[model samples]
Target: MIAGDPAATGRPGLLGSVWPFWVLFSAIYLMLRWPFVATGRFIDPDDELRLVQMRDLLAGQSWFDLHQYRIDPPGGVVMHWSRLVDAPLAAVQLLLRPLLGPALAEQIATVIVPLGTFAVILFLLSRLAARLVDRDLAGYCAVIAGVSFPLASQVLPTRIDHHGWQIAAALAALLGLVDRAPRRGGALAGLSIAVGMAISLELLPIAALFGAVLLLQALRGAEGRERIGAFLLAVWAGSVTAFALTRGTDLTNYCDAVSPVYLAAMTIVCAAGSSTAVFPRLTMPAYLLILAASGGLALAAIAAINPQCLAGPFSSLDPLLGTLWYDRVAEGRPLFTMNGVLVTQWLVPPLMGLGAALVLWRRASGADRALWLDYALVLAGTVLLGVVVTRSMALAAAFAAVPVAWLVRDAAQNLPKRRGIGQWAMSLAVPVLAIMPALPAQFALTGVEALSAAPAKATAGAQPRAGNAPLQAQDLAAIGNLPRATIFATFDIGPTLLRTTHHSVVATGHHRGAVPMRDVMVAFIADPAAARHIVVRHKARYVILAPDLPEISNYREFAPRGLAVRLADGEIPDWLVPVPSATTARVKTFAVRY
Candidate 1:
């Protein structure tokens, strides 16, 4: 019998109920995160920006208007982010606004949205782990998913962004793969894939992977045919629905987002795939021919819509911005390019899960073997994709939970049953294991440092520098009451100021604002005289920088006479007047003397 089967024996036990599991999981999550929850600090700029988007939506920004009006002025950035993520955050804030006031309402929204996402994940993973593992171990799967460091990091109370939602969508897709009803399973997986890709194009590869898997199954028989056709239809319908709802009427077909090109591509591919699935008995040669033709047609359609997007999302980014900003984005970069100390933490847990899945698949028989085979394949894809895109590790971590839970179960069984001081010491390891999906990741860092013969710049669990936190301080709040005008500052500071203060900014780290991003970098590192012209050209009324920001330090080191460096050294330019009242010792603020 499969794990957590309701009808496996005479009756299912206490762990059979999903509600009890969710409650215990939530209790554990809340207790572990109480301190961070109390502080309510967002560790990433995206979280702050997400809150800003929610505020804009609640403040009656047009449903169609995804632009950040405070970013880059008159023609502000038309954010590529979909409105689906912002909707719930806005809804929660609206419901509580009258009762708690706006500030408290937003605070409550931040806490609720992420936790709600966890609940969805809990529901899906419990069922999925039960089907794949032992029926009794399903709750363990949900618990592990909740506590897994890589996965939990995205859903913690203050992490109110689309990332946690994306992980949940990925988990739902995995669950659909193992469902008993083929048509229902395929439809669920397809819709989840569409939702994820709508939220972020980073999910496109996984969508394609699902299509391939379903099509491969199609070669088997009528059931496979039904599955693939249902998946294709669902994806096409769901993608169109999501696009209309999220994109509204703006069909400008931007290459960065899910534009008309992607729609057209998906349509062509789904049509071809569904057509090939019509026949009752398909030969191997016919299946290969159909797959190749369908893929080719889809590629041709994309090229017809916008050939540049064929290169990828960042293809249109300015070369200067690519070097100065986009390439330096730590999370978006490849796993190997990141800090060596972190490579182990990013890779080990997922790899361990994959290993566990392989071992189980080898030992299983018949139907169980087939289930494990599917699980292993999906885990392999997610783990590889996560390595290529570091931010995607959460997807891998989510899928890995089932196998990791099984591993945890096996470990617990081996724990010393007889009680003694030494046995108690051995028992302590289980709780430590529950805390982080991969506890040895810490030791792995020591291994990396020792092997490299040089310590990495930072440790695996290193916290952000306190002095670098310009967003959390009263210094930025001091400028909150100022007139709504552009603040010409480094990309890192732009989101902070936009979220904390009522002001616009020249550029943010988002790649879509490439032109303004280039302008900001050029203005910072150019000679003071040249810099002022660039700032004035953009109609910037103020210049600002955090002296210790990595970007500001880069400017100071690369060009000693640059405006940013000059400002850092307290060598105030003649055309600039300091805004001392709104400035801090770390953050320099100035009024442009145009």
Candidate 2:
């Protein structure tokens, strides 16, 4: 029922409805092309690590101790993440590699992740919109809003990561809730929650928040008893099923292993009594609050008891007791680190406020209001908790469009009741207005304009082969040749480097244990001896340093005093006492050395 036949509905022809999808798709496609088009970009955060992990998987690596050929001060092999994120992409690439070869396999896999992810998100969002709004309009809006949103521009066309998959699962969870059949909804919700938890534990709080809202909403309806019972049963079944699927082969054995938090959630749901007793009080705000609190407590308790459950078995250290916890707390001390409050948190709630007002102003029934509020709260909570920076915030920000659309619908309804032209213009305007704020940041990050201007920079640094190799041009070309080379690169270039090439990088994006490696990277930047030692130890063939990368601005500042100083002097530092030049093999952009 969720994915109906597009043609059979007597809706407009594919050509008629296709433009919205096309517009959104083209925008996303262009956004994806921007970094590749510009200075030959790379993702500095987690992309490199993921690529190495995939590489290892393709090379027949084990699932348990996912390893990377790290090139940081720590150098050589190190354990990074579990198989959950990398394995899926690796498997797809592996399948394609035999037929299409490794390069093509990688290309295919990266493309599929985003395309597949968008398809799944679109399908689920479409289902939810259909149930809440009209079926036809819902389908149109899901495609329209989903494609045009800046969030799509941000996530897709980068390397494949768990975050995009998480968004898809989140959409699925919402779809499950909105589905007409409670049983099916429950199962889907359970699965969605489990899969989403596996991808990013940051979403756990949001999941909990959502589950609580549903329970409270169920309690208030006329058939509240049955609704509440169904929802509780679904939550219990879903969690237990998830635990069973992940923990081991045996399903029955998971009972004894069920964490105390799970037990508490079950206990709370049971205490809520049958739908008969709970349903009559559904309209009271106090009842809703209590239900939501209880459900949230259940999730938090589980999280507290077994922190690993949220983000899967392989995870960064627990944020509370782990070293990273203290580091993050110290780093984010300006805000309440203990509470996990992030500063850029204000953006989401205000958007949600606008969405909420629009929802109310639309004169949507109580059920619609409740549903919107529930989704809004969970998403807002996730942002306030500082789970991630832009992507998650964008996910939450995207909901603002839904409410805005309804407001547009009301406006269109009131206008001279125009036929074709006015309605189309109004619909186009709503999404554009909703997504305007993210435009500048999106363009800047993607470097659409900067790409056009790169010719001048290339010309400025023409052929200054001071230190055996031209620093600027080769650095530009090195990223494109990365997949075939083992390179020592700054962390800022790590992600995009991984996405573009096959090279193994040292350290990327801060994880709990990466501080030591980062310190070593710092030493490499500050002291040439340390830098040489890092390069020599890793057997790295190439060294990549990007001055424009903002995250490694500290490293960037040291570039002039460190690497650039050596480049200017034409003297290899004593640490690299016997530095070798590219003697035998030289490519147009980069020199190949062993």
Best by lDDT: 1
Q: What are the lDDT figures for the candidates, one per model?
A: 0.78, 0.51
Model 1, residue 312: what's the lDDT? 92
Segments in model 2 whose C-alpha atoms lie over 4 Å from true places? 1-45, 69-84, 146-149, 180-184, 218-362, 366-369, 372-389, 409-431, 435-489, 494-506, 510-512, 525-544, 556-573, 577-594
Per-residue C-alpha lDDT of model 1 across residues 1-594, encoded as one tens digit per residue: 333352432245534545676676667666766765665556678888888887888888987898988889988998878898998888998899999999888887888888888888876776676666655666777777766767887877778878888988888887777665678888898889889988988788888777766766676567777777778878888889999998878888788778898889878777866776677577768866876887788889888878998999888788777776777777778888966546766577678789888988998786567667777888898888878888888888888887877877776776757477777665555445544524476577678768888556778997665455545457677677567788898887888888878899999988777788888989888888888889998898889888777887667666778888889889988989998787875677899998
When superposed on Cα atoms, how far off is each prediction in RMSD? Answer: 4.5, 8.6
Residue-level lDDT tens digits of model 2 in 116-194: 6666555555555455554454544554355444346435654466666777677677666555455566557656765
TM-score, candidate number 1: 0.89
Model 1 stretches astray by more than 4 angstroms:
1-40, 416-467, 557-560
